[model samples]
Target chain A: MPRYALLVEYDGAPFVGWQRQASGLSVQQVLEDAGASLNGGVPAPTMASGRTDAGVHAEGQVVQIDIALGLSPERLRDALNFHGRPHPVSVVKAAHAPAGWSARFSCTGRGYRYRILNRRARPALQAGRVWHVQGPLDAEVMHRAAQHLLGRHDFSAFRAAACQAKDALRTLDRLDVERQDDEILVRTEARSFLHHQVRNMVGTLVQVGLGRRPVEWPRQLLDGRDRTLAGQNAPAEGLTFLFARYPEGLDWR
Target chain B: MPRYALLVEYDGAPFVGWQRQASGLSVQQVLEDAGASLNGGVPAPTMASGRTDAGVHAEGQVVQIDIALGLSPERLRDALNFHGRPHPVSVVKAAHAPAGWSARFSCTGRGYRYRILNRRARPALQAGRVWHVQGPLDAEVMHRAAQHLLGRHDFSAFRAAACQAKDALRTLDRLDVERQDDEILVRTEARSFLHHQVRNMVGTLVQVGLGRRPVEWPRQLLDGRDRTLAGQNAPAEGLTFLFARYPEGLDWR
Candidate 1:
């Protein structure tokens, strides 16, 4: 069987998330269905770098699948896209992966972005693509506060109560907050994350943005490791999986 | 009565267009209703720089209204936005306009953008915001064709047969076409336009993009005055009225 790394893009609004479930549609189901259509009777289980939650969009999600088809990379890409028509999911790039290459374990970093629209009125076209926050946010103060939680820490405070990660401590490579016009964007990079970690941090940082919390509140929450100490979970709709990284020589095309 | 100029933004998915009609919802109707709520009476009639068609969005639509309210510019913006809550309309900015100022007459230029997703899959979240073109297009050729149609010309070939503009000749300040990833964007600027002119030009340019017509087809179409020579009208969903320009120091805020 030939292994291929697929660069994917999807609007996650109608999906139940990246993983398949009995209740609703999932990106995994869509890909596997297309895979089944492409390679008869061969169950092509797709694995991704991260299993994003429902309503989380992705412009550069990475996934890997094994198939017995002898089609070239270009033909496989065109065929998969042809079979996946009418679905919002798109395989933007397809290439043969080196043996033992996996999208999940081979990645060096994952980047996520959270969008916030700070305005008096609700969103129009950007309704579901951003978190609408009405009130003046002190971006400088929020940026200052976000820096305190940059390094390795026990992020239990920022992790969801239902998180299944056995370890709460992880290193955050970067967490930068910036504002553009009436919108604020938060960019975060890490090797892995506990469930709801990014959303929880955004929820807490928004409090700092609103002047409800001091600049050091984020560090305090991280030190305390208490989930109840954090602010409300930010809505899932505003988070986007930006990209997944791999080794330098790996072919992504 | 005090006259005010409003900077408006809206998602045009729900409205029939900018003009109020007997059949469907319109941006004019929504703004009037909001004004009526604030004015404690039937709202004063509203006027806009351009009356966009159904499913056409706007980011910097300009409108003017005369009312007796003694509200300041900031208060007027807040009040209108408050009244327009949950509606896809927003009053982004507002200011007192000279009594002689009219949204339609005082505008110097109008800008519009058409977004097309040139990929195999149907868009999910961006379903209504972009045209899904499931075939390859030569964007460079499209750009060349668009450049030829720039500057002043008789645009009768690109105007709809039902266009109400008595004079089909108009000055086109700019027409730019660019491609990013799987998306192609066409941006145009002019002082005014005939009905369906942008859509018609885009349709014809798409033919050039797909190699059905030569790169000079657009210029040829412009030289000819027959509307039947142009391509089909592109869908309205992908069109957006980007902005309207006024003379410097006009102080519309």
Candidate 2:
């Protein structure tokens, strides 16, 4: 059997996130159906790098699957896309994965982006894709505050109470906050993250942006490992899985 | 009566377009209802710079309305936005217009943007917001070809058969084409446009991009002035009304 790595993208609004469910559609179920259709009734199981929550989008989600049928990578990509037509999911790229390569363990880093429309008016087409906030925000102050939470640390303050991670310590490689016109985008990269980690960090940053918390609030939250010390979890809709890193020889492209 | 100018933005996906219709929702209908709600009972009639077709979006649509209410400019803007909630339309900016200011007559130039995703797979979240074209496109060739259609010319070849414009000649101020990754964006500016002019030009340029037509196709179409000589009108969904310009002293903001 040959394994292939796929770069997947989805709108997450229609489906119930990436994991398959019995009641609603999922990215996994859609991809499996596409693969089955292309393989003439043979279904394949697909594994993704991250299992995103409902209404959370993915621009460069990585997935891997094995198939016994023989198909060129280009043809397979086209067929999967064709079968997935009319659905808000797409396989943007596909390639043969190196032997024993996996979308999960082979990844070195994962990048995520959260978009916020910092303006008085609500969003239009970007309604569900971004968090609409009224009033002015001091991005410079927020950027300074975000730095205090970067690097290796116990992020329990930003972890959800329901998070099942056995360990709360994680290394955040990078955290950047920038403003583009009326929109503020937060970019982060980490080897791994606990459940609701990103959203919790954003919630704390939002408080700083709104002047409810001081500039050192993030550092203080990190120093305090209790989840009760953090702000509310930001909505999942504003979060997007941007891309995942893989070993050099993994053939991600 | 005091007249005010409104800078509006909207997502055209859910509506039948900018113009009001009895069959389905429209940006006009939504704004009108908001205006009625703000005015306590009187409905305010709004006039826009252009009446875009179905599925066409606008980021900087200019509209003007006359009202006898006591609300300040800022208050009027806030009130409209508050009432406009739950709708995809928004008044991004608002100001008191000059005594005789008009949205349609005071414009100097209008800018339009068309987004094309030239890639192997369809877009996920941006499905309806872009024109998905499979395979590679030569942006340099398309840009060179687009230059031939610039300047003042009779664009009857690019006009739709049902277009109501009496004169087919118009002056194009600027036309630029650029590619970012797998996406191609075309920006065009003109004082006024004939119906379907931008879409038709884009269709012809797409042919040039795909190598289906010669570099001189756009020029030939412009000189021919025969509607049958040009390519089909591109879909309305990919077109956006970027902004409208006015004389420096006459600009509201």
| Number of the top TM-score candidate | 2
Q: Candidate 1: TM of chain A?
A: 0.97
User: Across residues B1-253, which tens digit of lDDT does each residue of candidate 2 receive?
Assistant: 7788888888888888888899899888778778886666787888888888888899999988776686677778778888877888888888788777788888888999999998888898788899888868899999999988789998899998899988998999888899998789999999999988999999889998999999998998788788997877888889999998867433343
| lDDT string, candidate 2, A66-179, tens digits | 766788777777888888777899888888988788888898889999988888767886888988878787888888999888899999888888888899999998778899
Flag clash pairs in model 1: none
Reference-based lDDT, residue A227, model 2? 89
Model 2 scores a C-alpha lDDT of 0.86
List model 1 lDDT by residue over B60-166, tens digit each: 89998776777888888888878777788988888888758888998999999999988765565577898888789889889988998888889999998888998
lDDT of 1 at B124: 54
